[model samples]
Target: MKEIRLAARPVGWPTAETFEIAETPVPEPGPGQVLIRNVYMSVDPYMRGRMNDVKSYMPPFAVGEPLDGGAIGEVVTSHAENVPVGSYVVHSLGWREYSVADAARVRVVDPAAAPTLSAYLGLLGMTGLTAYVGLLDIAQFKEGDTVFVSGAAGAVGSVVGQIARLRGAKRVIGSAGSAEKTRHLIDDLGFDAAFNYKDAPVRDQLRAAAPDGVDVYFDNVGGDHLEAAISTLNKFGRIAMCGAIAQYNDVAPPAAPRNLASAIGKEINLRGFLVGNHSHRMPDFVAEVGGWLRSGRITARETIVDGLENAPEAFLGLLRGDNTGKMVVKLG
Candidate 1:
């Protein structure tokens, strides 16, 4: 088996040298364990936080240790009772060709229901669940509310916009890093208006896109985006602080929000959340998102890299806003 380990902690941006690839013997599954042949691995912005030597919702990845993320694979061998060989499953296996994990930690996936197993790592998985819970439960979004989403063309942001529309939001506006992504948001993902944050100042672009002001903000790229959203939010508006992808790789301290006073004056509620914190609501979320997908009301896009060796590059691209949607590594 081949696996990638964290060789060093990165400063500004992670480089190839930060990872070390090694060849190891494929181990057998222990009692109550299963061996998964990883097929697809998810690369998310949160993983960047794990790479750092800071305390977070999850522990940091130790140097020389194999990194782990969400992965979809087939169970090639199993010592567990319920999970048998050939079962498609999702587990946190990190960067490896195969992983031996407790069967309880993996969930069997229905290949017939979802055409591609990768969807379980994106739309039907944690990314989609995060958006659903944050917008519906945390933000308390209602019908006809004008929503503004930052990092709008990426995985969670894209899904957040579609779900808002499906639930009857009057208008959904999105912010992306490039012109092509802006078009993808408006034309493909049903965002009522989209803007390239690079083209103009965030405050100016948001002002133009949401002339009447925003009722709810699903924030993905924080920093200036949060500040801009704060400035434009209407009274009693809610903000879901999902991820701060913009400042993930910064060496210096991030710029503080300049409009927190607006939050107090407008009675805005800004909440930060991790998907794991809402696992109790997973069943309800899955039921609703499944219906949305079956009805073609929500669409998902993925930027897939072909090999595990390129996972680091794919992750770096994600921080730079280079991907259109969910970024995944296909390790067939």
Candidate 2:
């Protein structure tokens, strides 16, 4: 089996030199375990946090260890009766050709139902779940509310905007890093307004896009984005602080928000969340998103890179806002 290991810790942006690929004998499954031949692996912004030595909700990846994230594959062999060989599953197996893990840790996926198994790693999996729980369960979004999402062209942000619209939001505004992505949000994803953060100050852009003020902010990129959201949020506004892609690689402390006073005066509720905290709601989220997909009320996009060896570059691209939606690497 071929796998990508952490060769070195990165500074600012990760490079190909940070990862090393190696091949080893494929291991057989043990009792209660299964061997998965990985088909696809996810590359997300949050993984950047795990590369650092800092304390976080999740542990940092050790050097010379296989870097793991969410992956989808077929069960090549199974010691557990419940998950038989040939069944498709998703698990945290990293950038590998195959993985051996306990059957209980993986979820079975029906390719016939979704067609592309990679979708399970993206829209129908953790990314979608994060958006769902953050907006509804945590943020308690209400109908007719104006919604704003940073990193709006990426996986979680895209889903958050669409779901808000499907739930009858009065208006949905999004901020991306490029004009092309901004157009995609408004023209393709049904956002009421979208802007490129590079075009103007985020606070100014947000003000223009949401002239009525934002009721719910699905914050994905922190730093200036969060500061802007804080300033523009209306009274009783809710913020689901999902990620801080901007400051992930900063060696120096990021600048503190100058508009925290707004949070106090507006009674804004800003909460940082991890998807794992909302795992109990997965079944309900899957059913709802599935229904929405089948009804043509929601859509998904993915940027796929072809080889496990390219995983590092793909991930770096994601951090630079090069991907329009979910970024995944197909293992071959």
Candidate 3:
């Protein structure tokens, strides 16, 4: 088996040299564990933060050690009582072709529940939950409210807008990095309006997209986008501070979002959330979002990069906004 390890801590943007692929013997599952043949692995914006040796909500990836994230795999061998061989499971042990995971830490996934095993790593899994919790729970979204989403064509943002639209938002607007993504948000994902953030200042584009003012802002890209959302948000508006992808690679502190003083005057609620903190909402999340998936009211798109060896490229691409939806690596 081969696994990717963190070769070094990066200062700004990481290069291909940051990851090392090494071959090793596949480990046998110990007591209460399972040996999984990993199939699909997740690549996300948050991983960039883990590359740096910093204290955060999650532990930083140790240099010279295997890097891990979300992965779905087949339980080829099991030493646990409840989990049987041939069952599928999702775990946080990616960047490898196989994984030895504790049965307690692995969530069994029904292969028939979704269109693909990869969906467990995205829409039906953590990615979807992030979007669901961010909008409905953190932002406290409501019917008839106008919503704006940053990084709207990406996995979490795309779902945020769709869920908002489904929940009867009056108008749903999106901001993406490209024209194609803007089209995907509007035409395919049903975002009422979307704009290419690169075309103009985000504040201007957001103002233009939601001229009447935004009621809820789902922020994926922070920095300038945050400032823009703050400036244009209506009084008593809400913000789900989901991610700050824009400044993840920066060495200097972000300069924008200087309008936070306005939040006090407007009595706006801006909440930062980590999906781990909201596990209690999984039952409601799965029932509601799962029904939407089955009824075709929502879509889970993925940009897959084949082979575990290419996982580094996939992660870098995700940070570069090269994917329209969830980015995953397929391992053979």
Query: What TM-score does prediction 1 earn?
Result: 0.98
Cα deviation of 289, candidate 1, in Å = 1.2
Number of backbone-clashing residue pairs for each candidate, in the order shown? 1, 0, 0
Alpha carbon lDDT of each predicted model: 0.91, 0.91, 0.93
Candidate 2 lDDT tens digits, 1-332: 78989899898778888889988899888899999999999998888988887798888998999999999999989999999999999999868999999999999988987848888988899999999999997788999999999999999999999999999999999999999999999889999999999988998999988889999999898899889888888999999989988888788988857788778889999998889988999989889899998787888889999999899899999989899989999989
* Residue lDDT tens for model 1, 54-136: 99788999999889999999999999989999999999886899999999999898988874788899999999999999999
Q: Over all chains combined, what TM-score does candidate 3 have?
A: 0.99
Model 3 weakest 10-residue run by lDDT: 202-211
lDDT, residue 160, model 3: 92
Alpha carbon lDDT at 50, candidate 2: 83
Decide which is better by lDDT, 1 or 3: 3
Worst 10 residues of 2 by lDDT: 256-265
